[model samples]
Structures are given as C-alpha cells and as structure tokens.
Target: MGRQGLMAGYEDLVKKILRIRPELSEEDLERKVEEKLRSSPMLSRLGALLLLADELGALEVSDGSALPFDLSGFTKVSSLVSGLNDVSLSVRVIAVSPLVRLDGRAVLRMKVGDETGKASAVAWEQKAEELATVGLSPGMVITLLHAYTRSGPDGRPEIHLGKNSSVEVVEDTGTLPGVESFFVPISKVSTAGTFDVKGTLLMLSEPMPIQTKSGTVNVVEALLADEDGEAVLVAWRDKVDLLTGTLPGTELMLTDVRFRGGRFQTTVRTCVAKVARERHELSRLMAGSKRLVSDKLLRVLDVVKQPELVTLVVSDGVWVYRLPSRSMVGVEVKEGDAVRLVKGFVSERDGRKAIMTPEFGIKVVTGEDARKAPSVDRRRRLADISEEESDIIVEGVLQTKTPLGAVETRFGKAEKISFWLRDGEATVLCSAWRSKAREIDSMPVGKRVQLRWVRVRRNVFGELEVLVEKDTKVVVLEK
Candidate 1:
C-alpha cells in the first residue's frame, strides 16, 4: 500500500483499540497497538507517542466522553499538535547552562521555539554535540519531532526531545504572518547561567602534562575572543592537540563555553575547540620551551627523590612547570652533550624565582647527556634528612661541574658552584653557592667526590644549599 494509505490504516486500528478496549489497562492496550503498527514504518515514529497518549487519555476513541485513559499521578505529556503542523514555523534555539553530572551522563537543557510556542529540549552526550553544531542561537527557529514530556520541579509539564527524536532547523519567513517573534538576544541564552559562544583564537599555549595524584593529564590554555569580548579557553586531555599546530591568529568556534572562577573559561564538559581557518590566521611562532634551573634539579630530590627530572628531553618541544614545588616534567629534549639551555621567563614560587623550561625552548645538559648521558644509577637510594644537626656520609659520582665564581648574597660574598651528586636512586643538586663554587670549578664531570657538612638549609623551592663555615672538608675520591 502507499504511505498515506498505510498511515490511514494504522490510525483506524488505533481508533478501534481505544473503542473496544475501554476496560483494558493502558499497558495492555499499548502493547496491542504496538503489535498492529509494527509493520507500518510511518507509525513506528509515533509508536511511543501513541502509546503514551492512550495511557494519558490524550487520545479519545469515543466522542470525548471522558478520556478512557487515566492520567492520575503520572507525568502529563504536552500537546504537540499546535506547533507540530505549523508550516510557517521557524527554528529558534535557546542557550543552556553546562549540565552538572552526578551520575555518569551529562544533562543539558535547551529551548526550541517557533511562531506557535516554545518547547524545552534535553540533550545528553552525543546528541549535545549535534545541537551544538546546529549553531542554536537565541533567535533561530527549530523544528523537532518524536519528543516526550515529563513533569518539571514546578509540577508543570516540561517538553524535551526524546533519545529517538528528530530535530530540524527551519528558516524564517519574511513576515511570519500571524506569528509573533519569540527571538531573544543571545546574551539572555543559558541553561542555568552558562551560555554558548563562538569566537576566534587570538593566542594559544602548548599542551603541558601534569602529574597528579590520580595520574598524568595534559592541559592547554588559549585566549579566545569574539565581537563581545575576550576570555581564556582551557582544554583537557586529547583535546589539547587542537592547538598543537595552530598559530595565534587562528579563528576558533566554541560551544557550551562558560564563565568559571570569576573569569570566563571553557572546560571540557560540552565545549568544543575547533580551529577556524577563515576567521583568524594560523600562529607561526614555534611552541615555547621550559628551562630547568640548577636549583630545581636539587628540589626534585627533596620532593620525588628520583631522577624524574634528570636529563629530561623536550620530545614535543613543550613542557609544563608547576609552581611552589618548582617541578618540571614532560619536556621534549634531544640527546647530546653540552646540552644548550634555552631562555624563558620565571614565575615566583615562595618568594624565589622558578624558571619555566619550555617557555623559551631552554634545555639543560644532563651530565649523562654530556658524556653519552651516563646510565641512571638505579641502585642509588634517596636520603632523608630531618635533624637540625646530624652527621651523615654519602657516596656518589659527580655528574656535572659548574665554574667557580663569587656570588654576592645577603650574607656577604661567597664562591658558588653547582654539581650533581648521583648515588644510584637519583641525582641530587649540591650547591656550594656560598663557599664551594670556586673550589669545585676545577673538578671535572664524572669525578667521584666526597663532602662532609654539619649544617644545611632546604629552601621552600625544594633546592638544597650547604651551610659551610670554618669546619668543612672536601676530599676528591678520584681525579
């Protein structure tokens, strides 16, 4: 049979079921109706709605003599007939807030409107992306079908496109005869307070890997701007790659962006980071590099107490430096001797300056990389020092030796030099910034050295400095 004929036949069957099954339960009647309509592809779209209407008394078979169906305490389904058949209707989209997930799924609320009326739509996960692409603005008219309704917190019926709903965008009519404009400014669009925005990328930063208590996570920061204003956009994990090869002048389109932490920042909830070639120019500047300072080399020992930061290579030409701890990780470095140190800005940590290794493409020459990058001393164990005054003995090969020089400090002038002490577990940054720099400048890398000191100070930045006075001995284990 033809499509129209098939639809008519299903309608007749539905009418018959309502008339003959007045005493049947809503479920039993729905089951029978589904069985009859199963063969009709047209009716399949209405299967759930038909069953729901019959259950809620929305569909009457007998001359409206009191709906045979009981709606009782069940959620009321809104009537779709008003706007469903309006050919003059145009697509209108409303902005929604970021969905907060207590469970595994995120739930976002959006409103779709036409000349007839407005209806709310809920999107989860993948569907959310579809609605986002439609560029749902506050004034765009939208057409949707197969939607279901449920009771909202206010006891009023709320409309939403079901999982199987089909949504469409409708263009506006020139005059929209007899239809009032329900269009609102995009500024007023939001789900709960969050809104959607599209903009251009003005600046971007390379992905920085952070080692958290849970695991390693990559994060990137970018500056996004639109006609309205500018804001910071943050992307997480694999999304960080979006800005990898992108330049500062690139244009970007963002959805489900939000205001966070007193500033407008986009998180990974429903936001998308796409490079817009038409809107902005690709940034030609190479990714920034982070520099590892000699002081930080020692702090890593006090914190992780391992070779975690020793001889780090900038694999992707980008890295991250966390504050306070002055920890450096995930850097791209090539293997070579006399590793070149790149220049970069340093941020203050605990009143001390900490350098970012990746910002200026700076790299530190690992003593191992210096001479075939010596094999990591796996047997060396991390030392724990706690007492204010204690004598301890340590043995390790000198990895690198710095030139001795007089460094002016608050406590008068003193010779300073830095050397890496490796005992198997990890390399420790030993600095004689006050008294050893001149003495150790003559010491070559790879020469085993022994030192005895009674007092030392560990700085807040995790760097270790030796406190030498009159009673300190430095013995050369091997020349």
Candidate 2:
C-alpha cells in the first residue's frame, strides 16, 4: 500500500479515538498505536489502530461503518459486504417467513437485526428445513456461523446460509440488546406495516370462531397498553395459541404485526411471547368489606347458565355476590334455597362483587337452616322486555320446545335447546346452553316457569330472544 494511504487511515483512527476520549491527544493516540504494534509484531499500522480503538471502547460505536479489523470475529448487520463468505453475526429475529418451494427446492426467509440495523436473511435446502424444524419465531436471539452474503432481490446486501453454515439459539441473550429495545411503542403505531410492540395485555376476550370464505377461523381480541396509551390487537388462527393461557396484566412482546382498521392483527410472520407477569394473590384481591366470607350460609337469589359455566347470585342478607363455576351444574339448588359457600372469596368483576372459587364449593342447606334463609322473588313482564335491559325476570308458559341437540362451541361440544315462551299476547324465544339445556329439556311443555336475570337480545331473524346465561335462575311454579 502507498505510504500516504496508510497515513490517512492512521489519522482517521486517531481522530475517532480523540472524539471518544478527548483527553487523549493525537500524539498520545499515536504513541498507544506504536505500543500496540511493538507488543504484537506483524500487525499493520491500521491493525494496531483498530486494536487501540477497541481498548478505548471506540470500536463499539463504529456502527454502520467499515472497520479495518474484526477483533470480535462477528460482523455487524450494517457492515455486511456482499460476496463475503464465512461471515458470522449475532442478531435477534424480528420476523420469519414460512418455508416455500422455489424451483422445487425449499427456501426459508427471515428478517433479523442488531442494534446497528436490520437485514434480510435466507436459508436454502437442508438448512432451510432444519430452521423450520427448530420453530424459529420473532424475538429469538440466534447466531449464524459460516454464512455467506449476496445481493438480495431488492439489490441490497443479504445473508444466505447453505450446507456449510450453522444456526443456533443464543443461550446467553444478555450479550445482545433486548428485543423490546427495537419495539415501536404501541401508541405511536399509525402506519400499516410489519412492526414490533411491547406492552401489558390489559384485556383478553374469549376465542371466537369466524366464518370466512375459506372456512371458519378462530380469533381472539385483546387490548394492549403501555404508559403512553392502549391499542387493540387481534390474534388469528395458530397465533391464537400464543395467548391461550395468558391473562390481563401480562407483559407481552409482539413482533411482525400488521396494523389495519386502527387495530393490529397477527399475520403469518407475527410471533408473540410473554415478557413478564404481575402476580396478584387471591386474598389480596378480595380484601374489602363487601368481600364474601368463606363458609358462610348464603341464600340463592338467581342462577345464570352458559356453555362453559354457571353463575349463581347469592346474598349474605346484607350483601349480594355472584358465584360462577364450571362444575356448579352438579348442584340442583334454586332460588330461595340456602347454600354454604366454602373456600370462596369475593372479588370485583365487571364492576360488581363476585365470589371466586376454584371449583363448586357449595353445600346445600336443608331442614331448619333452609327456613332461616332469606327469600325474595322479582319479576318483569315479557311484553316490557327491551334489548337494552339485562338480568330481567319474567314468567311464561313453555308453548313450544325443540329437542335437545349437541352443538360445538368454543368451550367444546355442549347441549342446546330452544323454546318458545308465551305470556298472554307476548311470545318470545329462549335458548339454553350446556347444563341449562338439560334442565330445560326435562321440563314438559305447557308448564309455567319463571326465568330470572335472563338477557334480552335480537336473534339473526330480528326477533327478540330471551337468552339464558350462567346466572339465569329457572323456577317452575306448579299449581
């Protein structure tokens, strides 16, 4: 090399060192570079300068810039040069594409990035199949060894892995920056594109089946929030499994999501993982005066039945509480019946107090104890029912009943029955699900029954239907 070119490289390195450590004068940096060269003979002037910069912590900031030497043996994403072979990198996976066949051969693509910048990467043949088998997802830190670089379809530098290359999940992720650092805060998301977000899962809805032109697909709606604000997120198909057991207050990291209709939806490239969880003890959540006292004898006021659970509105005479359970169907208690609640605590739900229990911890009160329980009956006329009102009580004769049939719901297969309720000139349809279907199916037509706390809604036919839910109480009045 020409002496002038070598001198220029040394001068540039000295200037970089001076910028980071202004205390080190140009002469001092030259002396350090000479000392490094003296200690390690065979090192060129530029190589010695690079070593000195590493010792001074200046090389770390050489992002997106070409370095004379790679002491760490890993190349930065932004510093990648096309046609370079055996290049190694440590980066976090931001997105991944499904393995596809190109010319009848398998190829997998991924978007990876480091703190420096982002880049596209691909694996072909055996490597692509291996990566697919490893379940590569967003937010995972991986190291690629012996990979080669080439121009991508967009005429930009891209990393490619072949038979000689290797990929492994980094065991110690602390060496690299956290995945959340690359996230665009939830509130600032406005454009429709692939983006990563970090926030707390404030709310999660039950997975529902939606009919599409292709087929029925399962989807879950969730509200994610950060300190700035909240936004909606929808998980579709296989991505719904990522949120299956997660609850509100869980910290989440979502990657490769697409924003549309003012909401973020999980795409084929999207991946979700829980970052952290806020633990709340049951006793701490139920610490209030209106809380339910465990093992207390309570009077049943109403019952609501749904496909997944049953809710009973019970009262301790002074305070009312809603108790819901999936196993409560086994208990055959009705309104005015007294039951002892065991191992249950009161917690606020839907802005109302409720009794939370792991199972049906109810024991029926009988003999003299039942007579001491409080009793109350409230009723609403069927003709006065409106779609806006909920938890309405009404009495009518079962004019027509449908045979019990099994139907598949999100909660699983359950029995269902629809019946026509007639009161004077007013007639309405009522549908019971799960255990309530069996209860209603046993009752003969033309019997007078009172349904308390039933929900009113219009069916698809635009006809008013009284919906019996987990908390609706069905009482048959035999005269």
Q: Rate the local accuracy (lDDT) of all candidates.
A: 0.45, 0.72
lDDT of 1 by residue, 1-479 (tens): 23354366455545655565667665775675576455432234334445545554545545544432222322222344323311112334543434434377655666544444554556666555555554455444344444555654434445555455555443343422221233322223334345445545555444565554457877656555444444455666655654566655555544345655423444443334343464323332112212113222211111121233422311122222222112334443332223343433333322223333334343345564444322221111335543233222345787876777777777676677766777676676666644355566767778776664324457567565433322234668886
Off by over 4 Å in 2: 1-165, 168-178, 181-197, 200-225, 228-251, 254-300, 303-378, 403-417, 433-442, 470-475
lDDT value for model 1:
0.45
Give the count of colliding residue pairs in each prediction.
Answer: 43, 8
Per-model TM against the reference: 0.34, 0.43
- Model 2 local distance difference test score: 0.72
Best of the candidates, lDDT: 2
User: Which ranges in model 1 have alpha carbons more than 4 Å from their true place?
Assistant: 1-142, 149-159, 169-193, 211-216, 226-229, 237-248, 267-269, 273-479
TM-score of the candidate numbered 1? 0.34
Q: In model 2, which residue pairs have backbone atoms overlapping below 3 Å?
A: 303-471, 303-472, 304-469, 304-470, 304-471, 304-472, 305-469, 305-470
